[model samples]
Target: MNNGVNVTALAVFVLFFLLVTVMGFMASRWRKADNALHLDEWGLGGRSFGTWVTWFLLGGDLYTAYTFVAVPAAVYATGAAGFFAVPYTIIAYPLVFLFLPRLWSVSRVHGYVTPADFVRGRYGSKALSLVVALTGILATMPYIALQLVGIQAVLDVLGVGGGAGSNWFVKDLPLFIAFGVLAAYTYSSGLRAPALIAFVKDALIYIVIIVAVIYIPMRLGGYGHIFDTAAQKFSTPKSPGSLILAENKQWTYATLALGSALALFMYPHSVTGVLASKSRNTVRRNMAIMPAYSLMLGLLALLGFMAIAAGVGSGVKGFNAQLSVPQLFENMFPDWFTGVAFAAIGIGALVPAAIMSIAAANLFTRNVYKEFIRPDATAADETRVAKLASLLVKVGALAFVLTMDKQAAINLQLLGGLWILQTFVSIVGGLFTRWFHHWALFAGWAAGMVYGTYQAYGIASPATKHFGGSAANIPVIGEIGYIGLTAFVLNLAVAVVLTLVLRALKAPVGTDETDPDDYGAEAGDPKTQNAPVPAAAH
Candidate 1:
């Protein structure tokens, strides 16, 4: 386990990296659209992805390398609580099955590229859409940065980079190079980059997980031995007990899963994935089937227990718990198989990082640039701006990876989810009902965002051993709780109160910018033909 790089294994890893990089750049031609220059084409793969393609694309985008590394790592450290991720994902598919079809219908009917675009039209408020767009872009950047960290962990395991006193620039050079390639293909191909590369990413992930879950257990003795050893080790007073929920954690676990399930489809990146589908049925069918990824997640989380049985932490010092899976495989598997698993983690990072950057860039271009800066921008002009914005977003994420501690990715991602979840009350709720006034919604969003940040800043994680986000200890509530859910409650209360006040005062609630039927019409349908093109972007 103290060994340096294996040259043959290193070669395999590099070869696969180059192959995937080529595949990523070549994606622009895979499903070449008629024009390929418009936002609808470039930002959303021409809105023409079939069921299988979207299944892979979204699977790749959502169940990421971070899941592969971090979930097991969590299990290695904490036990059953880590399985929170698995149940959350499984619960999510059922909820997505219910909500995403409505979203897809509304998006396609209006030719929406970003959810904030739909929000703008539905609420008739540029300010509200701007907030949602900015939140999406901000939240997405940290998630992309986490993907980079996933790749970084694989490289560190492969003995690629980093050493004592290595400058930040030198330590992270490989990550920067990886980010550069991702940013390039995303700039050229947008959503198509991840769409094409997702096939490879998911295939490798499945192969590695199936092999690891079965192969590693036999190597370590048997599945029963793995669980028995894990129980013995963790059953110590300080360890996370039994592979089941403790009573205190059950509420938080269930609520986190439910809240995250609600917030998952609300993410702009999630919406970007849905909007790229060819039809509403594609979205629904994909949701119905996507829980297969959750099953994979369950298998992956068990690796943490396997790692424990392997005595993964017996003597290691200052070791990253996050890197436990990679190290476990490196110690247990043959060199060649280890190489393949590492590459799976590395390439897994690239797929979603590309898609996330593309999604965030599209939001900035359509919602911010065209809305405020260049009202006369053409299709070509918007695509070019989006391409450039994609690069900036990647560079920003790279800056985050380098300047902050590597472990910051986990905390930042939780913070990002909390920030974006605040948008749900306005964006998701507004799609079904116009009951909430636009001005009131904006005010509520502002209040919720502040409360969410304050709570997140107060959270502490053993991973960082510092203050972080996701769950917070509310003062009067007297214990740690989920920040996003708390803030969302505040947001709803404010919106309701302000709406009633406005109704009583007979204040102008602003005219609806979109008609009801527009939510159900296809792009070329007569209903949307004469409706004013949305004047605001992100």
Candidate 2:
């Protein structure tokens, strides 16, 4: 019930903050490249990450700040249904396993930096590439902001409370300090910083989870009792339903998970991480080994129930249920362990925020600035622009926290998820075949983005009671929804129909820019330098 900061806990937090700061700058030399000056070396970490490196990098990239906070928060507020994150993680690797290799080979063969770069070359449409790039940058800003939110969440738990009244610096100084550290390292070390620091990030997360999962349960009672208590607490007679979902939500869960898996790799950060891998085997092994993180996630989700059983909100009145985990640890453990838990959350926020900002910046540089604004921009110029852009992305994310509702920021993330998913058809589908025309694909992307954004804006949840709720909508025939999946359907439909229309008009179908055989090729593969490397590790 104590609300004051624990000085011992604060010291442990300070130690982690300093450690990651050192790790970030030191990462520049970890995977020494022929030349760090090259765009490939700086932007993509030399395109030379080995299997273990890629494993940690991709795990760090995909399992993000939201995974650490929102998933567990969802479990605390709801019940078993919040476990949707687990299935999504399970399905994503296998689903991406099918298409990512093809993407890697094509990108490597063509020297493509962004998926938009691939679309531009393959379908020969600057306009289409612009759309993809813009979508990526737009979707990514809120994502980057959410990472800040993750950092804020952890900092909030650590008792790094805001200053008096609306004082700007006091309220935001912690955020500024965290992001400044992140931006500086990302600017200096590029992808290598996150690639290397991911090792530390993942290790700490594992340690935290293992300790909390075992110790928290033993201290409280047991898993069954915890869940049983949570079920009782959250159960509602007004709805005449258990806290968990019925059969209907299960279908929605499965569909959303499947849709999310397809969307997962389409996000530019996911591609940026994958492209950093040294070989196909690295990517494959990353996918194969990354599931271990999911085990941690399953445990993390249970913290919600543990929070309930510990009577996290029992003593207090009107305490934010989202603060359940923080309270749980504070009450059960001494100040020292509490600090470690807070450090885990804080560091977790920084690593992915750094990666997401870098990824978004690279997309803007490669696909937007170089492609559109300065076709002849030098590597140094590109790097400088990226560094500046990364800062702006972080600042923009901070603006989200300041200007918008914190709860609204959460919904914006789901909207980002939906928008990014639409790119799947062009990015992943095109990897296997160039059958879809540039114009067709462009049309598909446009339609999907608009529809998805609109639908997301219209969605009203019971809690928020406004826009942004469930991903699926109840339909007449077979609960057919999942905005990402729906947008994808619209995207494919537009692509297919337009392909036929464009063909009938005998319009020039842009050259088949990528060779399919190159999907299986590697460094020795012919014609590799002209395009960006596709899913290289797996």
Candidate 3:
């Protein structure tokens, strides 16, 4: 069968795309800077976002199009296990409420642009900062690719994944156009573009999910039937799993949920959102209330079951389970509403993609380029390099999109979570205490990253054949759990043991630039507020 684009959905998707493009360009003016070329102003939107704006910015940053597409796809594919994101987000926020505030205080004090910047100052180790910076960028690359996967899922559902008469050019043209707009605005407006566009993205998503939650269940006979139908599908020989956590796999669920919750805030984009807030209060307020998105996620997860009941993506050609939610929207909704839902997914991808790029760029500029390449770079020079770096970051992520599989979002994102979680010991651990030696932290991170990558690479499955899975059977842990979490435990143990050994040897732990007062410092606390970046920080 020849694939053909749905004209109405395409039109609506383009319409919303144009709307955000305009807003993206216009956002450069939102917090009018005398010279927006300064990193503080351009890279972080002048740090002027109030409570509500921070709410939307963080919301948009935390949840991406992948969450919309992949989470449902997971549920659609694996029954109960897909709901791991809900518990992850729920557990993540409380942790953020406690830890992020101090990071924010220190960041605001030193005018830090990335988490690595804070690490550079707190530990006074360029190598340590470089590790954090590289991890942030590497983990983020796959994440941004997953956003494209989200876009591809929508395009596939609309019959635009290279239709029979259309070549690959025609199939991917819309995605390119959307990305071009995103890259342009992100370069011109920096953080403001995504910050402003996030409001629209969140609203459209809320509307779509609210509609899908209420309308789809009614259309599918009812919620009970939807669950029954899904449960029946899983029981068949072709697909075997329980709708609740399986007995032996219970630990898998527990570890995955815990590990993911720990990893969530460590992503650079999440930190970028928090740092962009106008004040510490803004960060605190947003954390407490941000569980609202978690609630939406629960409703969104239901759509996976709804898709199963509707027989969406059952045996469709070129269809992956990731397209399940898009297929459900396309199959069940009217053309116009389907367009709105598609736009939500498209806009959703753009918002996070832009932020992830900006955050990556900031890391390159602050921790890599300025630190090593040109220590004399002024804020303007740093900002210019960051802007160009942002464009490059997007291009790299686009490569992953063009070359990777449909399930790349799931596998790569899982890898991203695992790889990034290694930094938790350095960034989060350093935030609370300074006892861990820099060498010890770096060594621990190295051990975890190497083990996690090797383990994930060895697990084989039908989808990937190699590097095919994120879970494994382990000693002591009878159930299969996330390899990342297990590696993290190793990472922590190694760091603790090494720290004690290194300290006993009287080895240098690097200079601690942060004063205890810095953690508790507020906006008006001059000692921390004007804390200077030391000469050796980089």
Candidate 4:
């Protein structure tokens, strides 16, 4: 396996890539909106997706390129610790099931294009909205880049190394072309592009996973040997108590899992999928069943162990742990099946990448650009600005991949999880009651932001010298734990204390535009009706 392109794999990847590119552009007409230029039309696909489409969109949004690439990689390298991705997904569904219906209902009623718009309407504070949008955009950048990292993993296995050189443009030309197609179609088709492509992505992913899970274990002398072999490898002094979480590492795993569960739905990309649903019922129905994806995730994580069992990692040159699952497929399967698996991984990057860019773009347009720059801007203006911002977001993520090592993308996303978790006090709490003062919420966010950043920056790991990791020492628990969870605790406590003190001081709590009835709204409910357009939706 020299660093030379495999003709068969490259051919398969190009055909699938071109297929989705066409589907993405044509999706602008899918369930064609009467006026397809507005945010509601372009950004949210006219907010008319039913159960099936919403399922695929949410699956594509949450089960990302990172999950497919990183989860297995983590388990292969760190043993039971990597299973944090498993419980996080398991717990996230129930939590989102409880709250997302309300978010969807209120967003549809208020014509909120992004979570930041929800914050602005609920708290009536553009300042808080900007903070929310900025946090979301900052957090999403690493995540989007990680998707490209996943694509690069597949590309690397197919014998495309981009060759180490200073000719950056020539070396990264293939990556540029792939994402350029992504940015172009996402700009034209908007949410509909991802909503349609998600079906294809999920189908390919399901097919690949089922085949791998069933076929790989049999080849590895069955599942029992895979575990036994993994246990032996992790039993050395360098990794004492590694196959299972050590006594001291339990808190780290638990906190990371809980923090991740909390942060998952809070991401703007996740919210974008929820808001695109036609009805609140659609959100609930999908959450009820999204655990099916979690099941697949557990299977995928096992691939890491399978790679170790097959001794797949030792054979390859330039082997990264991130390539565990991809390299495993290439080693175990024939060329045609390897081509299919590579295509699946490649397509998987596109769905979440498109949705995330669109989501981040919507935040900048509605909250930052429109709210700050042009208060009277028309809907058409917002859409146009979003299309361009989406392109820039992709470009920023691409730059992240080319300049830094791939592990940095994962670490940056860990930092992002800590930062975005601060918004729970403002965004999630605002969904239920108005008792939490917006000013207090902002202060809470600041406290968490400062504390989490300092902690994350101080963390030193093997990958980098500073901003090294997301796990840190817990304050009260007196153990290593996830920094994000600790920060959220700070955020919630500050919001609580400040809410009481501010009320005593007679500080102004902003007016809430949404009524209580809006929380229970479903499709066709009067409260769920779209708010009057501001002349620009025409």
Candidate 5:
């Protein structure tokens, strides 16, 4: 690494940063609406994005800075096991293809701004909707924090941030500045900011990854030498890694992949992307093409092996494995190109962080604030509250980054997936049927949240004592697996059993306001275009 600042690279990084910052502020005018003050316009970009726009928006939202920094970081640290992300993403697109269009149709017909809105309308239980909304907001905090962590990794390698031992203010000032810029643009332009910026973010990422996979290998002799070096590193007798999955970890690998696939679209931000599309066909078309990102993710994961070959973290005392890919770029690429790579990671952070805060804000405004605090809130009021809430959400995420471990961005996200997955039975199950008693679904969600949190808390890694990992021993089966999937199973069981008991006792099951036709509604249909904005139950 360079002994001091990489001036050429830092200049290039700053230039791209300024360009995106300009674009972010200008996005409020990109697709100008009649009245931009309504929640539908500000929070969902007027729910009018077409296939290509939605494609890039979803691409930017789903394939985040975490994908760029953390996935390879995990591969750099744990060898082949890190590649679980690749398969899980592939699995996720196919799974979402089945349900997302249904969600879009229903959301369009009712003007539902959030998944929690659908839960509110579907189950007619304020309590159930409240839990779903709170879970989404809670789970999103750490996920947003992971994005900031990704940006921090880039800044650290660029020699912009002070060392780990510096005063906290000195160390974190750069992150705070980035956070401020993101919050300002998001608050000002709302979803339009990220939607517009995603085009630039996705293009830079594709360019950087494509170049890295090809250019870095030729500089490292070839893929043959790269794989050999990675294998030899993992083969060191004390190392707990391997060039391939170990037989003992196969269950963990498979479970994590399957569990993650199930939970991916369950995230409020993911659903927000789908709901923002102009039509159900746009959503379906995007899903079919979304797997292209999975292919990029596969190539991106190879950077881990390339980092190993490049000796990125070798012999550095107490090195953060998260820095492997960034350091590798600095070591191998020219300073100017290194700046571009850093910008890709930096802007990658902005796009999703903006969307996540907006999603969390929408949940809070529609479910918590409107339903409980102010049922009389108008469309303009909802948008204003959501905008403010978005700022607060980013503040909370910044706190997470300031306080929590930044050892690996992937672990932070998995920790969130564990909590967010608990809502799947409520949201996804509600989509297909209302067979679940609202109260029973509540019971199931509560049970899953308690169990998932407890299991994750007891998992200890070398880095910390609690919530250190996402895997643990599967109950009864006694095999190790993902805690999230295990909790999801228990959630399903509780909901199913309680539903039967509730039915036998003749307990009240809340009304579902939607009709069968609502699920088939499209953008220009009278039912969809004329649908009234959902109001909170009095």
Candidate 6:
């Protein structure tokens, strides 16, 4: 990487950053709502986005800056293992297609603002609801912090921020500026801020990826030479990775992919994107079309191999693997276009960070505060509290970035997936049938959370002593697999056994507030007419 600042790249990055900042603030007026003070308006974009809007929103929300930076970074660090993300994203849509529309339908019918709202209403259990809400907030903090890490990687490449040895304020000023802008717009405009800015973020990402995949290889003597170079590097005896999956690694790869696919929508932000759609069909349509992002992801992952071909970080001391892709762009692209790629990474961080904060805040306001503290809070009051909670959520995420080890932040994010997946039985299972007892599901979630955390905490990596990785050896199977998936198996087994015993003993299952018809309701139906008005209608 250049020791001096790339002034042209920094200028271009600032130009695009300022543009998105303006758009984020202006979004508050884009779909002006009649009662903007209501949680329905502030939290879910008035639950009125159509197919295209919902598509972009969900796309931007899921394919974040971290994915842009980390996927390639993983590839740069571990060869084909990084490609696991591509398959997992492909697997997620089909799996989600089967159930997400039902969630949207029920959420629309009942005006549920968060997944915890659905959980509380479904099982009528405050304890179960609280755990789900807390898990979401916990999982989301590290995820949001990782987005800041993505921005920092780009800033480091551009030489915008001072070096790591500098005073903390000088080192992190750019990131704090970006964070402040994101938090301010999100607080002022709520979900609309991210929804509006997502269009720009996605467009820039696609453009940069398309250009990089084409241009970078040509400059490197084509894909043939790029692959040959990458193969040669990994072929070295002491190299830690390979160009293809080793036989022993197959189980880990498959289980991680499957576990990730199942866990993707269990996240509160993913559910928030689905709930914000205009109708059940909007949710279904977006699911069908969302895989276009996977194609981009596949192309983006090649940048890792491309970085290897370009010899990025070849002999740099204590080089961070996360900076490999950013450095590659700076080395190959002209300074001005390098700024654009950096901006894509920077703005990519903003869209998801905004949505994540909003999603976590909505969880806290609805599930924790309103459900427990003040059951009689009005819509306006909920909106007010959610806005403040959004700011606090951003502050907590900033703490994760500023104070914690970056690797630890990443490990927590991995744990976030494991943590969030534990909720699948309760949220998804409750959608189809009330067969599982609420207390039994809660017990199952607790079992999965404890076992997953314990196993993850015990696994050690070269970088850390505890909480090192997500995969571990299965108990009876005696094969290596994702700890999350194994814990999930244990979770389901417990839920099933306890459910059978509880049913036989005539345990009092909580009342289900939903009817079969609620799962099929759509926008403008008489059943949903009393729901929040579409923002566009105002």
Q: Note the Cα lDDT for every prediction shown.
A: 0.82, 0.79, 0.87, 0.88, 0.91, 0.91
State the lDDT at 510 in candidate 6: 79
How far does residue 338 in candidate 2 sit from its true spot (Å)? 1.4
**Cα lDDT tens digits for candidate 4, 1-538:** 4467778877887888899999999998889988876888888888889999999999988888778888988898899998899999999999988889999888888889898999999998988899999999999999999989888888878877466763877767778888889999998999999899999889989998999989999898999999999999899787533788888888999999999999998999999999989888899999999999999999999888999898977755656788888878888987777888888888889899999999999999999999889988788888889989999999999999999887788888889899889988798899998998888899999999999999988988767887887889989878999999999999999999999999999998788899999889888887665554434454
The TM-score that candidate 3 achieves is 0.96
Candidate 3, residues 112-186: lDDT per residue as tens digits?
879999999999999989999999999999899888878877887787757567676786886787788889999
Each model's Cα RMSD:
2.8, 3.3, 2.6, 1.7, 2.1, 1.8
Each candidate structure's TM-score, on Cα atoms with residue i matched to residue i, is: 0.94, 0.94, 0.96, 0.97, 0.97, 0.98
How many clashes in candidate 6?
Answer: 0
lDDT of 3 at 371: 97
lDDT value, residue 476 of candidate 3: 86
Off by over 4 Å in 6: 532-538
Q: Write the per-residue lDDT of candidate 1 for residues 288-357, one digit (tens) a residue.
A: 8898998899999999998888887677776678888998988888888888888888888898888888
- Each candidate structure's count of clashing pairs: 4, 23, 0, 0, 0, 0
Worst 10 residues of 3 by lDDT: 529-538
Better of 1 and 2 by TM-score: 1
Model 3 CA deviation exceeding 4 Å by range: 315-318, 528-538
Better of 1 and 5 by lDDT: 5
Model 5 steric clash pairs: none
> Where does the lowest 10-residue lDDT sum fall in candidate 1?
529-538
